[model samples]
Target: METHKSLSPDPNPAAEDDDHPAARRIHRLALHLNPPQGLHSHGDLRMLACAAKGKQLDVSTQELTEYMRGKHRDVQERVYEYFNSRPDLQTPIEISKDEHRELCMRQLLGLVREAGIRPFRYVAEDPFKYFAIAEAVGSVDMSLGIKMGVQYSLWGGSVINLGTKKHRDKYFEGIDNLEYPGCFAMTELHHGSNVQGLQTTATFDPLTDEFVIDTPNDGAIKWWIGNAAVHGKFATVFAKLLLPTHDIKGIADMGVHAFIVPIRDLKTHKTLPGIEINDCGHKVGLNGVDNGALRFRSVRIPRDNLLNRFGDVSRDGKYTSSLPSINKRFAATLGELVGGRVGLGYSSVGVLKIAVTIAIRYSLLRQQFGPPKQPEVSILDYQSHQHKLMPMLASTYAFHFATLHLVEKYSEMKKSHDEQLVGDVHALSAGLKAYVTSFTAKSLSICREACGGHGYAAVNRFGSLRNDHDIFQTFEGDNTVLLQQVAGDLLKQYQQKFQGGTFAVTWNYLRESMNAYLSQPNPVTSRWESEDHLRDPKFQLDAFRYRTSRLLQSAAMRLRKHSKTLGSFGAWNRCLNHLLTLAESHIESVILEKFIEAIKRYILVSALEGGSFAIHKLTEYLSFQVRNIARELVDAFDLPDHVTRAPIGMQSTVEAYSQYTQYAGF
Candidate 1:
């Protein structure tokens, strides 16, 4: 193991002089930002405490660290034992055949009773309310956790609101009580991302007053469905609604609808007569989740099974929908998926928060090289160390703030039923989820390295956190796929402006963009001047607004021009590059702006208290830290280290040595 010597920059006489305008300005900004107080705050940190508590096991941080250091077999055994021993702490309710389903439901309900949190009430609380309940059920694994969380969050509240009184009466209570574990099966093996191309069909059967659900081929089977393999008895399956006539074929033939299909027997845990289930097998991470594939062979469900928020059918085979446009209807259904993306982003934040805490705490305690004549200094004192870790710390804070803002926006949009706002939320959520998860993957690894060899040790939590977060980038929707959506939306906005002939708007955007590009080279260094610029509030606000607008406009132009030279598929392929760039820029702008706002509002408020004065100092330090690491973090997004450095970025021996020095203080 090798350790780098910590270098303390020589104090500038000018910086020490309080009377100096630069020093005063820096101090003022710090006071204004109101940084974090001592290590603890507001009755233990919400992020860490929540995550630690979610594991259900009362193991201390040290115990967790030791567990990680032990053999893989030992770790797995402990993990399973911890979960199985406390069925009361976490429930594993599965809905299958009559007997098995009833037994599991009773077991789950008993656990719920022990927790003293009602089924309905749990649905309305944090883990459940926010779609993180899967995290509570430790053995469920990440895949199942995410799937369950998404299903519960979507159906727990909105489903009840959207369904008819009869539909609600039949399933809502059972679902709330975990008496009927349900699967939200939408993604097909052949067309996971391309939902419009789904081949599963639900034809109206007037004779039985039921819809005949059929998966025409192997591709049509529901894949990667959590709980579907073993736990789910019923599923909210999405299929195309094939109307009787071709007159409405273009629209109606392509009509995608949701149905509540029974997939398994309640007692025997057997697949229904026509249904088949296969466990998805092992994955890179999220093993607790029982991801599975399901094939429906002419599965039958009553007409009333349709979750007709936007469209419905009568027993007479008559079709009706308030939304005339099939696109709009599709949007409404797909829009529900946005919550999953948003929740994943927040979860990433939580995970990153833990990583940052571990890295930061480890850095503070672990000492490294110093002058040969002196004691070793904390590695955190090195600029290179700070460069590696602080930006991630800043990013963690940035993501935290961004997620809270997004959730607030989503909550309001849901309350007002604002379509425009909903679109914005969808776009933003997609972009942020892609951006945050991608960065989290990189950032977690960096934190691991920053900790040196200790980071590789399972006990530090970095390895598991990294492994758990690995799936986030690809699941829900792949980052690249989601970014394409963001890019597509931006391109549309660009097309609108171009067609509208908003020359002034276009020129203004270009000019601001140029200014931002130029400003990056010669960032304002005068603390006093920059402080003045930031304090104007309007300037800071406009900076982000302008940056986002310009990035969108520029990317749109590039994509449009690139598309013009190619066919539709080619155009889409070419546009992806530009789209990713723009989406990243937009997400970065949001994060920075949100961080600034949180600092101003929340941090500043605490500064007025005498006991809270240290917070102001911490805020000042973090602000400077952010400024110092901004370029590196941005570089991380643009040119990931993995791409730039071959074996260096791959899991390498360097990371091992780095971790060794960090923890063992070699």
Candidate 2:
């Protein structure tokens, strides 16, 4: 079993200099915040911190990049190099939406032709390579990245996963070569998150041997479909499948199924008859992709167009499925498309790396106020500055490691198709997608503020990165809904503990999580504030496990209790806030465990030192360790300056300031 399903405090012995103004202020703030009290210090902690800053960072940038990029490094680097070589591929500042969209389309084609990105072919041979191509493109232009995903990962994915051999033979190459751009028409105007509630209909017409795809109401119009406004000729339309009952007035609702519906003429590039397309228009970011709304008025496609991997309707309009129920078929179908969530998780971590890379690099070069009469210190030197960027930097590294692990697990699950493995991967991907994207989205803003006015400049790229990434938390599954899914899955695992059910590899950690919960609040363990204790990876892991188990137990009981009065659905709604906390606690534990497992010896010992689950707060002594190795740690992320495109991210301080000044027209 995979060991996933996948820390304390300190003392004040540093002898607060009662007369020192800074120390006095610290005490006052500490009191106001009502901080836990234990006055002690780590003896020789300063010496250890100094040692950590040694002559050179022990880790190699190439080695770290190799680990983070995993097995897809070749494809990643190839795509990266292709874009790096294309001067025009670099997006311009404040271009019109049409121009930006045109450029993105151009880049998408050029990347396919020049970069040799065979997205569908890669998905067949190695999905990681496909994701690598997407991730690499995203690092350069997110709009283009999303455009590629909409075509390859969603529309093509639905065909590949839901359709069988005939579908693959006919459409795979076309989809791969861009001969038939496609959209995943899943989200409706009135139903974004609730797939089961969608009102679009695909009624089987036995007489004509066709399925009449219809938007029953305005609510059923497909909205926010990438590639629908322009370029798309086909779509994987998800709608309720209905079968005629002996030509009577009644039809049987067979739940939702995916059908290949052509929305435009391949030869003319014109909207097909009975299909109306409306451009979604420009918004906060990612205007490069042509997002549009789609409404189908009794559009007809052949019965064979239904992707029949899970269910099929015979010529006579009799529906049959191997799956026992609509819910099971829906779950299996959606499970196959978990690749999107995994890809989003991978791409989100990349965004965080760039955001932190730019922010940290700028922080190291830009100077601000310092001791009187002394040279102004680089903002990176101030404790407050380190607090802003260092922990984010650490968590970036941690999330990167976790995302890498997630990629491996997803690959394993896809190839094996083991029910247990699929469940683990599904829940893990959902949790990480929600957690990591949300983190990266917020981090982008924090990074912008950390850079002050410069980050606001379009040249710095923070604002665009911030805006483009905001939608990540909503798509691939809304963050809140995804977290609830995680929490729901976790609650099942909680119940299984009593059923004597063995946990899956992903949730294997659950087998032992209860031990920590049972023994936690060990008065001594809770108050252990020494540096060594906090730094010990075991204590950190144990503390995280304990917190998660504690929350899981509490949340499960809360739901059970609420159900007594509010009933199941109402009970869930009542306990949602508590459940989300449980889900976050579980995911963070998985990430920290993976981070420690991946690179414990690295200077990021403090990466999660002050994490919420920590039993005891870390001391000021640990800040030096973070400061000493923060540069080396970010370097290990190995993002080149060219990819960042921020004038303030140069290695040389003088060059950084000079470039920023030039960008500012000074």
lDDT of 1 by residue, 569-603 (tens): 78767666766777777666667667666656544
- As a TM-score, model 1 comes out at 0.70
Q: Write the per-residue lDDT of candidate 2 for residues 492-559, one digit (tens) a residue.
A: 98888878887767677788667656565532234344545655778777777777888888898888
Lowest summed-lDDT stretch of 10 residues in model 2? 1-10
Name the lDDT value of residue 419 in candidate 1. 73
Evaluated at residue 278, the lDDT of candidate 2 is 97
Clashes of 1: 21
Candidate 2 matches the true fold with a TM-score of: 0.90
